[model samples]
Target: MSHQRYEADLRRLFAGFPTGVSVVTAQAPDGTPWGMTCTSLCSVALDPPTLLVCLRAGSPTLGAVLDSGSLSVNLLHQHARSAAELFGSGAADRFDRVPWVPARHGGPHLVEAAHTIADCTVTTEQAVGDHTVVMARATQVTSLRRPIPLLYGMRRYGSWAEDMENGFLSYDFIS
Candidate 1:
């Protein structure tokens, strides 16, 4: 099989898996706010509280984090579907539509839309094909412990309806 075929298969397989939605936010050196909805965030360690976010190559938010040297991974709640949609678009000013406050770590935090957030400083980064895996040491991590988190599956935004007897429960896997 071709390498491209393997990549396509991997994408399809991952897309079929349900995942939490998050908005990775940061500010440029010029104080411009930048954000993008991401589903590729993961916790890397616990002793030092490290996390990593996989962002598309050449994304402005990636550059912002690299410049600012910090980021906030805002985990969006179920009600933030619209916000997720907006930030994930090609709009010139994504932050204009959302209510946010400047994060202590030089980023924007959508307090109302997020269930929680993790502020971190960039420790390392690596290019992974079309994406960059950014490893950061969390400076502060906050969680509301909300019951429901925004979900993405099969390339669509959705919510955690409930645990049904019909095998329609939420997938317990996070990648």
Candidate 2:
């Protein structure tokens, strides 16, 4: 298959698997903040509390993360769609438009948009295709609010709805 064909096919395949939204942030050596919206987050292990996130290769955010050896993973809430788009847009002034503070590990924490924040230290990284897979060890995890996750799949955004009768979470579509 051609690269384009397989790429589009893989995208369609993953679109059937919904995932939560997150923003990975890092502080450059010169104090510049860099971040991007990411959905390729996975838990690696619970013994050491490790997680992995995939970021576009050569992005400033990825560079900062590798340079500083530290990062903050902000798990965005349902109300944080604007932040998700802002960070995903590769806008130069993304930080200026959002309210954030330095996390305990020195990475930027989205104050208003995140339901949880995980401060981590870079453990390992590997290049794969057009992205870099970063494995980090969680040093701290702060739960700022109840989890009403922002979801992305099917080429759009969505959220979780409470099943009032069963008190369970269910998928709710949004434009």
Candidate 3:
């Protein structure tokens, strides 16, 4: 297969995997807030409460996080596509159009996000190509909204609804 064909195939393969969308935020020096839309966040452990987030090496938030020594992961709801787009944009004043409050960990937390996990100090950073995997210890967590989580599938945002089972298989099945 040719290089172009390989690239297309890789893209198609990745398109099938769904992921939860989140906005990772931190405050830059001079009190400027910065954030980026990311889907590369994952829970690494529960014993000590750890998580990992991947960011591009050249992202503004990356530098801010490193400088400030902390960051916040805001899990967006299915209705927050606009907020995601705003943070993903290249605009300088990204926070000017969004509502947020400072977390107890000193990171900015999206006021309306479904949930937030604020980390204090990065425990480890591993370089991978043009991106870096930042592993941090969760220092603070909060739930700001009650709703279905935002999902990314086929490159779009979707919601999940609970399916209730009608009266059917029950009590007598074990007999």
List the global CA lDDT of all models: 0.86, 0.95, 0.77
- The CA-based lDDT of model 2 is what? 0.95
Residue 146 accuracy (lDDT) in model 1: 83
Question: Order the candidates by lDDT, highest first — what do you get?
Answer: 2, 1, 3
Error of 2 at 65 (Å): 0.2
- Ranked candidates (TM-score, high to low): 2, 3, 1
TM-score of each: 0.87, 0.96, 0.87
Off by over 4 Å in 3: 165-175
Query: Across residues 51-169, which tens digit of lDDT does each residue of candidate 1 receive?
Result: 98998889899999999999999999888888888888958877877889898784798887899988899999999999999999999977766847988988777877666677575
Model 3: lDDT of residue 122 = 75
Highest-scoring model, TM-score: 2
Q: Which window of ten consecutive residues has the lowest lDDT sum in model 3?
A: 166-175
Off by over 4 Å in 1: 1-8, 144-147, 163-175
Task: Kindly indicate the candidate among 2 and 3 with the higher TM-score.
Answer: 2
Candidate 2 per-residue lDDT, tens place, 1-175, comes to 9999999999899998999999999999999999999999999999899999999999999999999999999999999999999999999999999999987684899989999999999999999999999999999998999988999999899998998999898888888
lDDT of 3: 0.77
Residue-level lDDT of model 3, residues 126-168, one tens digit each, is: 8898998998888877766675567776766666555547634
